[model samples]
Target chain A: MEKILLKNLGRPGFHTIDSCLVNGGYNGLTEAFKHAPESIIQMVKDSGLRGRGGAGFPTGLKWSFIPKDPTIQKYLCCNADEGEPGTFKDRGIMENDPHLLIEGMIIASYAIGASVSYIYIRGEFVFGTRRLEAAIKEAYEKGFLGKNILGSGFSHDMYIHRGFGAYICGEETALLESIEGYRGQPRKKPPFPALSGLYGKPTVINNVETLACVPAIIEKGPKWFSSIGPEKSPGPKIFCVSGHVKKPGLYELPLGTTMRDLIFDHCGGMLNEGRGLKAVIPGGVSAPMLNAHELDTPLDFDSLAAKGSMLGSGAVVVMDESTCMVKTALIINRFFSHESCGKCTPCRDGTPWLTNILKRIEYGNGRPGDVELLESLCTNIFGRTFCPLGDGAVMALRGALKNFRDEFQHHIDHKRCMVS
Target chain B: MFSDKAKEEIQQVLKKYPNRRSGVMDVLRIAQRERGGHLVKEDMEEIARILGMQTVEVNASAAFYTMYNVEKPVGKYHIQVCRNISCLLLGAENLIKHMERELNIRVGETTPDKKFTLSTVECLGSCGTAPMMQINDDYYENLTAEKIDKILKDLK
Candidate 1:
């Protein structure tokens, strides 16, 4: 299908504002200026655009949540802190075609009545950070940013806020706290960012890919975008295929594409011709894995959710038969444990506890009831944490056990990895 | 204490945020870079003084994030290998072992010459280019023993 998000990528000097302008970059902001902010939000609502950052919340609905009063201060935060394992699509947009993201941010800021915005990028993305800094400068020089823009009354200023190495900051509240120079920890909900965020004012936080889609939704009519993929989760989604694939990279396709086609047709199947496919993490490591038998499942928000997994961040990780499922579970659990912000008692304590058990099982010292112990631990931590970090760890481990309980049992019984 | 030039850069960064406290991340990054790859106690105190935050608050913020190397110093080239899920599935462990053997340093140690520090990070977000490592600010991906040797040789 036609690429909306990554269209500017791979073009010569695509990162430059001149090239982006030639490719009809700021046309969205120009189009946006012609319409009232309410109409733009309504147009986005009609487009059926969902947030690409794990949670598939409607982007228009999110924008509409901002208090309409013009006097109350509001801010828009573009979450460029792409720390989810196996997810690099945001990095691609930020590094290659940064202007696309900047333009999208400007339009989004206008729609949400945000006079100021921040791109909270991860600290390790030094190159992407510099690219965005230069691109923002270019945008400012062209009057796309600062005081008035394209004769429009909306005045917006965008800045880059680099986050230190904290995965929990990917959470919206944690991101806000990090931006406010506090420990990156999730706060209690109900007074959500839409109501009171970012120094206790109304704020709208969007993922990089989510905001990047705004320009396209505004440029092309909402019907055009809504008709591309499934009626519920429509739009061209960037599936980041990595691990045990022949062609492991970014593939922008319709959202409802089958996992089988994504791996076999798009990614040239698995890397090891002899071993074949073992499992596929349809989203990042957070989402539950799909065994080889379930490759026919369509990769969308609702479809994956129906099959006990969500299309989170569109990071499809394919693992071959050579991979030890037990080890894979252990590695995933270890990541969550390491990244768990010590805010909640259950997550802070339970993740490392889960990791310790997974480690014992991977090292062939698992007792008979270790799987049951893990299941119990998962149940305890699933909804008990301050955020979904603990739930993600449990879901990943549960997915592994659901498909490869035999692998864990084999390691326990045989005292060695079943694969190796 | 930061140099005058570093202090000026910090001032510029402070202007970007609405509140002075919001610039702590960038300020800490600048302090770390100025101190040659790590933050010392005095640097945190200086940042606290500049941002109008308590020194403990600045230190807590620094310790919460993994990128800030508090209470430790790094070499000229800080090599962080990706040992996360995607990288692990593609044999990042072997490449990390290769790096250790060549550098004569463990995962979190600096070399004797203070030229290279080998460490393993969660994920550098370059999983597509599996078996990747980051040297300072740049990414070195699709790595092998020969590539690691060549990169180390050039750095040395």
Candidate 2:
């Protein structure tokens, strides 16, 4: 499949507006301006593009939810807070070929009738931030932004809002709060961001990769895009491969590519020839992991869902047999414990407790019934938190227990890691 | 008190948003940078005055985010190694140990000369190049012991 998202990547000066225009960037916004905004939304809906930011929400459907009244101020936020443990694809887009994202954002803002947009980038991504800031400046200077963009009488202002090292800000609502100069904590849903967002006005939030697809969808028509991948989830997906893979990097393939091909063929198998695959976290740490037996699963929204995992952010973390499952669980839980926004009691309190128990087990001080105790704790915390952070921690621990229950048992009973 | 340059920068950041409160993070970031990598109580108070926000609100926003060092100052080089699962699987812990041994300071501790502070952070989105660390604002990826030694030695 042809690479739509990363097509301009690796070209010298691809991040510059001059190079981007030479490579046919901003053509989507020009094409979008020729049609009614509603038609562009419809085109996106027909293209079957889903939000690449974990939840897999449809992009056009999300845009359509905005109140059609043009008088009300609407905002579009590009979520660049790419802090998920094993996910790094968005960073690649923002740091390299930033004009692609800028063009996509312009097209999206135009489609949604948003005159203002913000790229809420993570503060740690200083380099990506500089690239995006420079690109936005270039776009404004080139008459692609500001008043009467491309003589279409549609004006949009884009700004870069740097997130101050809070992972919770990746959540759309929390991102809105952060932009409002408050603590980055999630707000209650039912009035989603599409309705009451970014200062209680209608807003649309999209991941960096999801918005980057808009230019291609408009320039090449919807059918050409929807026909590339599987019928349900059609598009070029960037899968970030890391961990014990021999060649770890970003691989852009059609959605629904099988995990076996991604790990063995694309990533060059395990870290070395002697090492065997133990398990893989098919998404970020938030998604349920898949054991080596489940390597045949196709990596997509629906397929991974059917297998009780998720294609979250398309981050595939490969682990070899030398990895101890118990230690893995402990490390993952510790991350959740540290990152859990203290808004939810169950998440803020329960994550540390989960980390504590996992640490005890990994350190060989675990007693009998600790494994069952963990199972009970997961049951209590799974559906009881304010947001998905608690559920993610529980799901990750449950996935580990489901596949490596005996390993946990051995750690408690034998006082050492089973593999190591 | 903020420097004239920082105040000018804060005003520039304020112009980007409709609400004055929306500029709090940028103001705090500027204050932290001006104060040499950490925010002081007086700095937060001054920011609240300038932005028409409560000092408690400024402090809360500063404390909520990890990048702002509200409590203690850091060294010239803040060496934060990624310890998330992907990096962990690639011997990030060994890298942390190596740094500790070389610096003669444990994790979260500044060196005796206050030149280097070693800390373990969660993923910085460089997972494809495992065992990575960020020094100040730069990323050093695909690390080895020799690479780390050179990186540390070359830093002024």
Candidate 3:
């Protein structure tokens, strides 16, 4: 598919304001001012846009949830804390065409009646932060931001807020807590961010990729967007394909693209000869791994969910036949264990237990009932935790066991890795 | 004492947020960078006084984040290797092991002279270029054993 979101990427001087303007940049902000904020929301709704961050909630529905009251302070937080293993698309947008995100934020904050917007970015994105800061300054100087923006009587202030390396902050509620100068922990979800968020005010939080898509959806009519992909899942999507692939990088495919095409056609296939594809983590570590045969499945939110997986952050990590499943499970669990935040007991306690058990199995210390113990632990951790972190950690455990039981069994029975 | 430049930067960060506390992470980073690459207890006190926060809160905030160094001063070269899923799948383990052997130090140990400190971090978001490591602010990716040799030799 022709790239709309990443078209400005790698273009010389794209990060600068003049370069972006010359390439028909802030025109989306201009296009947005032509309609009422309600009409803008309605257009996004009509576009059938879904949140690109792990959750596939409808973008328009999420924005519409903001309180209609004009008295409360409303906010738009851009979740750029892209530390999810195997996900790297957001880094590209922030690094190359930062003004695109800045422009998207202006249009989105205006639609949601927010006077302020914050880009909650990952601390590891040092280069991204510098470029985005420059973009914000440029946007401010051009009158695209600040009071009476573009003379539309809609004022929006944009700022870059850096996160100090925590994965849980990627979750919206935890992100709000981090923004409020507290530890990054998930809050009880009775009052969602749309109602009371970011210092107890109405807030609309969105992923960097999701917000970056808004300007284009407004520029092109909604009818043009919904016609691009599957009716239920429309619009272009950026898949961050990594791991053992011939050409592992970001592939911008229209929605409903098959996982097989992404790996074989788009990414150029497995790493090398005699290395057949083993298992693939369809999304970030949070999503279950798909087997070789399951590669034919369509890569969309509904399609993957039907197959007991999710199009989470569209992070497709491919592994070759030589890769060790047991070791992969161990490493993924360790990531969750290190970043659990310890807010709630289920996640705080369960994550380490999962990692310890996986470590023992990988190192050939599996006991007789270890498999059953893993199953039981995953069952307890899957849905009982406060946030999805608990469930996400177990996704690797569950998927590895379900698809590659033989490899795990080999380690348990022979007390050695089988892949080599 | 915070440098004049760091204090000015802290003030600018404070002005960016409606709430003063929201700039805690940035202030901590600046303070850590300015004060010989780590936040001492005294530095935390200065941070608390500047942000109008409790010293304990500032210390707690520093401890909560993985990037901030409060316990000990980091070496001039802090080698952070990414052992996350993507890099792990692509020889990141062997690369990490290679570095361990080459440097004659373990993952969590700093050299006696404090020139280099080695640690394994979660992910640096450079999955496309796997087997990557971050030394200070720069990322060295698509690394080979040969690449490691050259990088270490140059740094040495």
Candidate 4:
């Protein structure tokens, strides 16, 4: 019910630095500067805030991953490369409330003892990138970002690095590579960004929405923050509910808000002459599809996982009866095939193979054993690939097959998509 | 090859970078803007020659991004409809049908009049404002057939 993350959106001149200042925007960073970095980290940890980025990684735990030594020059990276198929919550926050992201970045930088921060935005987000860069310039001019903020002994510099339009760059390591002015590709983990990232030093990468929520967490205190949602996944979250819904837009609510509220109450139900809800992809295309029966399931990381899906990026994609699952799978598979970084074998080979197979099925040219081949190929690529991208591709294929096997059968047997 | 005026603008962009190769993306962007949408193969070769980099490097960069249309000629107004999961559910299929019928061209094809080119993009990061389409650089959100018709008429 509380509008913390989206507090300034839709308000007059909310994009301006003056309007942001009037609403106590940079006050959190000033408050944070007064405290020790470890104390700020402790406060964040106590707040029970998790990453609003699909991963739902614990924000405090991720910050704690950074080394405490002052000699080491740690980096704070903001994952504004929102390439998830259905997610746009970050863009809204970045465009309308750019200063909030700046303030959050400053607080996060202070918490982790980071001197420099980078907001790596997607290349296609031309307007959002310009707005964010302008906001950063404004922040620097106002002395909220430059050296020794508010007469305190903390100094920070922020940069906006625009991506060259690669979905793989949404991955933290790939984002680091892109920020370093290279072709975006995912790096092997275990060295994880926190331990050895961005010039092989300790770095912290937080999502745009995750960082945007920090100022409110800092201002409202941890107890108030923890009480908003389910105990494990507490705090407010912004769900970008779209597709088929009458009032399709972003809705800010507690983490455990049900699918019913999102689809029916918030989004004003499906369009197209009161069409029945066919299916729902709870968290972008990467997350598995849930039928209308699963609408009662709570929207949370664990809850969605228990139902064989993920709370990925909070991009709730609704489907109506007119959608053909086979065609949908083919379309989604094409994205994976194109976006795969080709770091490993399974994803590099498997995605294209699956995409080709799905394409054949969608086009009414599928062979008899194509379904089995698709499943086997997906199984091989699911966990074997280097990054979660392969897993996403595999999950998308398998989820489509599982929920709509009859459609795949229809494509093969009938030699045409059943739903046109 | 780029014209003298275009070349001068590109040189200013190149100055921002330490190495010429670093300016490859910016040069390609400027060149595309100069020539309208889509870069020709010759453009890539010329850019590589201008930047003192290998042609493959420029080609590779051009190939990686979806924004750069390397092969085809683009229409004056490029309309990219978001047909990913979100937009798909929000009558993107119907919208696509309407676009094809109105423009008399299929996806990835330009209208005969060279006025409009329609293509489907994955996501424009405007899912919050779903059923959206991008014309050139500006976004038109919460799209309906009537709205799209009005937009096309305005473009015409």
Candidate 5:
């Protein structure tokens, strides 16, 4: 119920230094500077906060990945390149409350012993980039970002690196490659960014919402933060509920909030009067879709995973009877096909192949074995590609097939789309 | 080669990078914008000549980025409607339909009047404001058929 992360949003001049200062921004950084970096990391660890950026990796564990040696110049990268199919929570946090993310970055930088941080934003977010740039300038002018911060002798500098609108750059390694001024492509992991990233030094990447929640966690002690959500995935998350809902918008809720609460209570249910819930993609297109029977599933990392999906990026997409599943899969497949970096074979070849087949099915040209072929093609692509993009595409196809098998059959049997 | 005005605009981008080669994309962006959206094959070659790089290099960079509209002539007002899962779930189909009917043009086609070009873009990062569309650079969110109609009328 408490509006911690979104408190400064809608406040007049919230992006400006004066208003942010008035609204208790940078207080966390000021307090954080007084303690050792290890202590701050420990506090975050105790807070039970997980990354809000789909993966739900422990924020503290990610920070601890940075090498302890002071000799190495570590980097902190903020994944503001929110290119997920159904996710826009990061854009809201970056645009409305820019300082929260900035402040959170500063605290996180201090905690991880990172001397430099970069907020790599998607190029399509022209307004968000401008707002964040202005906020960074304000932070620099007010002496919150540069050399001795609040007279604490802790030095840190931040920069905003604009992406070239590649969805692949949303992945951590690819983001680092793009920030380092190369074509955005994912590198092999195990170096895992913590060991060798961004000029081959230790690095840490956190989502915009993940880092934005840090200042609040630091300001409001670990216990208070831990008490809010479920035991494992504690703290508030920004769920960007869209599609079919009457009040489609961003809702800040606790992690364990049920799907019913988010879809019905918060988003004002489906828009049409007679239409009932057909399905829900709980976390972006990468996550598996849940049917109406699964509405009671709690919205958390573990809970969603237990139900064969993920809490990916907190992008809840609602569906009604009016929606067509075959068409939906085609739409999602088209996105992956267009955005696929083509670095890996499975994604580069498989996505378009899947899309072409789906298009055939949707256009009433589906063959007898097209549905089974789709299943086999998805099997080849899943877990075999370089990054999560291929996996996401495969998951989307499988999800459509699992829930809407009848539709695929109908297309084959009737030789036309059932919806049309 | 780039015009003097474009050269001046490119210098602003050059200031951000220490090396001139790093400004290749920026120079291409400026040249594309100066030419009013679409970049001809000659434009890419000229940019390479201006940046002192090979023509293939500039061409590759331009080709890699989706923002640059090369070869084809785009409409005066480019409307990129987000048709990904988020937007689609929120009636992007209806939004696309409204656009098609209002402008009398199909997706990937420019209107006969040359006043509107409707293209469906993937994920413009405003999914929180779903069923949204971007007119040129500015984002118009919470799109309805009525709001879209008014927006299109105002643009005219």
Candidate 6:
């Protein structure tokens, strides 16, 4: 499949309005304006595009959830808080091709009848922020964003909002709360964001990569998109492969690519020819780690789910035998501990305890039951939390223990790390 | 107090939203930038006054978020190194220790002369470029000791 989303990947001046126009940018929005809003929504519905932000919800179905009759207000939020430990694909689109996201947002807002859109970015992404800010400015100056945009009598304004260094804000509700200038915490669902989000109006929040695919779906019909990958989850997915690889960067390919192909063929293999691969965290740290021998697992949502893992944000972090499994578990525990939003007891309390146990085991001090205790802690925290953060932590750490119990046992019995 | 220019920018930011409460984060960012990389009680109070919010509310906001630096000053260069999983796998911890030995300041400590402040941050979404550090607004990726030395020398 050709790269629809990143078609302008390495183009010089790709961020500028001139280059965007030269390369047929905003053509989707122009073509979209020619169709009735319902047709646009219907086209997306037939595309079968799932949300690329880890939760594989159908994008068109999500847009259809907004109330057809305009109510008090509506909002379109672009989740650019790319804070997942191993996920960096969103930042690539934001930095390399900001205009694509802008065009997608325009078309999406039109389809959803939204008058305003906001790009909520991570505070650590200062570089992406600069590029997006410049892109938004150029978009506005070219009448692509404000005051009857392109003479279609549809006016939409866009802004770039920044989170103040919190990973939980990646949650859509938490993102909504942060944009509302409160403590970034997740709210109870049942009134999901589609109905009441972003200032209690009808809202549609999408991941940066998810929204970046919209313009293409609009330009090329939904049938063309659904044909790229497997029937359920189809599209050009960008995999972020890093660590223990020679060519560690973004590789845009069709979905259902095998893990071995991505790591070996695309990323140039592990540490070296002699070094044996130990494990692969196929998704972000939130997802479970796949053992070295499970390289044949297809890099898609259903395939990974069938394998007791997930294709979360397409973050493929590989580690060779030289890497310590205990330390890896400890590092992930620390990340979840520091990022737990403290909204619930399971996540807020259990994450730190998990971190503590892993730290003690990694530091050459381990009790005989420490491994089982760790398992019990993960069990207590897994499904009981109010949000998925708790469940995500349990999946990652618990997955590590189940797959690398020998490594953990080595730490406990020998009272030292196995790698060193 | 925000300068007139900053006040105008804050107002413009506020104009982007319908409710003044929604503009709190951006307002705080403006005040932090205007006050030279940190926020003070008076600055929060001033922002509260401008946005029709309480001083305690503004102060709590500034304290809750990690990006805002308060109660202390950083050096001319704030070197925030990444220490997350991918980064750690690629030896970010040792690189941080190397930085400590070279700079003579531990993580979270500023140089006595205020020329450098070394700290570790969560994943900056640059895991693809592991063992990376951010100095101010720029990301210095694919790091090594020699590259660190060059970056430090260039910073001066």
Where does candidate 4 stray beyond 4 Å? Answer: A272-274, A416-420, B1-31, B38-59, B70-73, B110-115
* TM values, all candidates: 0.99, 0.99, 0.98, 0.91, 0.93, 0.98
lDDT of 3 by residue, A1-420 (tens): 668778866576677889788888888889999999999999999999999998989999999999888888999999999988999999989988898888889999989999999999999888899989888888889999899988899988888889988999999999988887878888999799899998889999999999988888888878888888888989999899899999988888898999899988988888987789988898889999999989889999899999998999999999988999999999999999999999888789988998898899899998767888888998888889899989899887899999988888888889999988
Clashing pairs in 6: none
lDDT of 2 by residue, A1-420 (tens): 778777755665677888778878888888999999999999999999999999999899999998899899999999999988999999999888798898899999888899999999999999999998899889989998899999999999999999989889998899999999999999999799888999998999999999999999999999998998788998889999999988898898999999999999988788878988989999899888899999999999999999999999999999898999999999999988899999988889889998999999999999899998988889888999988888999989998999999999999999998998
What local distance difference test score does each model get?
A: 0.92, 0.91, 0.89, 0.85, 0.85, 0.89
Name the runs in model 2 displaced over 4 angstroms: none
Cα lDDT tens digits for candidate 5, A1-420: 988767655665666777778888888888888789998999999999898877888889888988899988888889998988878888888887899899999998888888888888887888988899899898989899889888987788887766766888889998876665456789988878898987788888999998988887788889999999899989998888878888877888999899999999888888897998899999998898999999999999999999989999998889888888998899989999999998999999999999999999888899999999999999999999999999999987788789889999899889877765
Interface RMSD (Å), every candidate: 0.6, 0.6, 0.8, 2.4, 2.1, 0.9
Q: DockQ, in order, for the candidates?
A: 0.89, 0.93, 0.82, 0.48, 0.55, 0.83
What lDDT would candidate 1 get against the real structure? 0.92
Q: How do all the candidates rank in terms of DockQ, highest first? A: 2, 1, 6, 3, 5, 4
Model 2 lDDT, residue A68, Cα: 90
lDDT of 5: 0.85
Give lDDT tens digits, candidate 6, residues A15-105. Answer: 7778888888888899999998889989988988889999989999999998888655789999999999988899889888899999999
| Number of the candidate with higher DockQ, 1 or 6 | 1
Q: How close is candidate 1 to the true structure, as a TM-score?
A: 0.99
For residues A369-395, could you state the per-residue lDDT of candidate 4 as single tens digits?
Answer: 999999889888888988899999988
Worst 10 residues of 1 chain A by lDDT: A5-14
Model 6 alpha-carbon drift over 4 Å, by segment = none
Q: What does the lDDT read for residue A292 in candidate 3?
A: 94
Residues B1-156 of candidate 3 have per-residue lDDT tens digits of: 877898789889988788888888999999888977788898889888888899998888888889988868888999999999899888888998999899889999888889999999998899988989999888898999999999989999
By summed lDDT, which 10 consecutive residues of candidate 3 chain B come out lowest?
B35-44
lDDT of 1 by residue, A89-182 (tens): 9999998889889989999888889999999999999999999999999999999999988779789899999998999999999999999999
What is residue A385's positional error in candidate 6, in angstroms?
Answer: 1.1
